[model samples]
Target: MLIEVIIKQYLDEHLDAPSFFDYPDNPPRRFVLIDRTSGGESERLPNSTVALQSYGKSKYEAMVLNDDLKKVMRNMEELNEISKVSLNADYNFTDLERKQQRYQAVFDIYHY
Candidate 1:
């Protein structure tokens, strides 16, 4: 879970919004939720596909938050534990049923 910690800490420091591994009972108007969708090891090194969902008061706000996240995420390789960071995809992942505006950014993170 080093990558998780690295991502969370990095985002927490660099982004304007808060980030969480689990959704909070009382959430902020804008935040980011981090999830490790899939993962595996290669020769003892770890790699994972992480999904970071940004929620905002409006669709435009969500998109802006996601963009800001992307900009910072691309620089995660500078951190110690993370070896590489690659964006897989990012899109509107709004909760239509709940009517919550959200955007999701997926990434392939390789770490030692």
Candidate 2:
């Protein structure tokens, strides 16, 4: 559970923010950990738009040169899917990255 450990570490390190990580884009963003118990539900979290942004020649070229953003986004998506399945709940996910933002990050979560 490296991802869980990493998420816990990140949360422990950054308690000021509502969530652990934020993408550096136009809009301020965070992952909302959904609690699904007693038939109660929480808000859906935003999804990372890094993959969409990485499309096109220039951005693809840049991503090829440095895979940091892509890797981060992939990890985020994996975490989101895992959380969704683990919690057995639906999520309201959205991407916040704009066309102008070359770098992107996705955030999402679910809890049981």
Candidate 3:
């Protein structure tokens, strides 16, 4: 949840953007979803990955938001004493609506 909280906080403070942990019915055209994926643990440390997907009405719009988010997270590899978040992957797709474009930014997070 550290990754989720850190990402949400950053989006809130910097962009004042709408973000969610899971998909919801009729979500805003412009929004973000932070989803936790499979991960592993070594001793007491948890190494996890999360997906940050930015959605918009157009591909360029989504890309713009994702790029801005990436810039903001460039040096945030460290979230706090408990977690470190690093970018993993960047991808793009369309939502079920087809009209909604989405750009995904995945991150790997490690917690002590």
Candidate 4:
């Protein structure tokens, strides 16, 4: 459900945004990728962690998109079903070409 909500929000905000894992012949200059890389469960309760990455041609553009996502996720607790949606510190990454860059922000969703 968290992934669904996130993907929906991104699409609603950015019409031209690329969908998750959508490898095309020629990708856009800017887009997003969301994946649930890891999670934890105990006593039938679960904690889900997702990686949200904003890719861009420039460092500033990457950060700006990443920050926009962070702001929207900051108050996601309002949904009530999720116990909390918190972000860890973010880090930037660059390709081997050093021409493209991305900023990754990880979020932990405690769903009730």
Say which candidate scores most in TM-score.
1
lDDT of each: 0.93, 0.31, 0.77, 0.70
Q: In what order do the candidates fall by lDDT, top score first?
A: 1, 3, 4, 2
What are the clashing pairs of model 3? none
Which 10 consecutive residues of model 4 have the lowest summed lDDT?
15-24
lDDT of 4: 0.70
- Tens-digit lDDT track for model 3 on 38-77? 7788777888787888888789889998888777666565
Candidate 1 has which clashing residue pairs, if any?
Answer: none
In angstroms, the error of model 3 at 83 is 4.6
How many angstroms is residue 88 displaced in model 3 relative to the true structure, after the best TM-score fit? 1.5
Give the lDDT of residue 3 in candidate 3: 52
Candidate 2: where is the Cα deviation over 4 Å? 1-67, 73-102
Tens-digit lDDT string for candidate 4 (58-87)? 899888878877786676676656677888
Candidate 2 structure quality by residue, lDDT tens digits, 13-105: 433223323333433332222121222335653221111222212444333422432233334434433443221222222333434213232
Which wins on lDDT, candidate 3 or candidate 4?
A: 3
The model with the greater TM-score, 1 or 4, is: 1
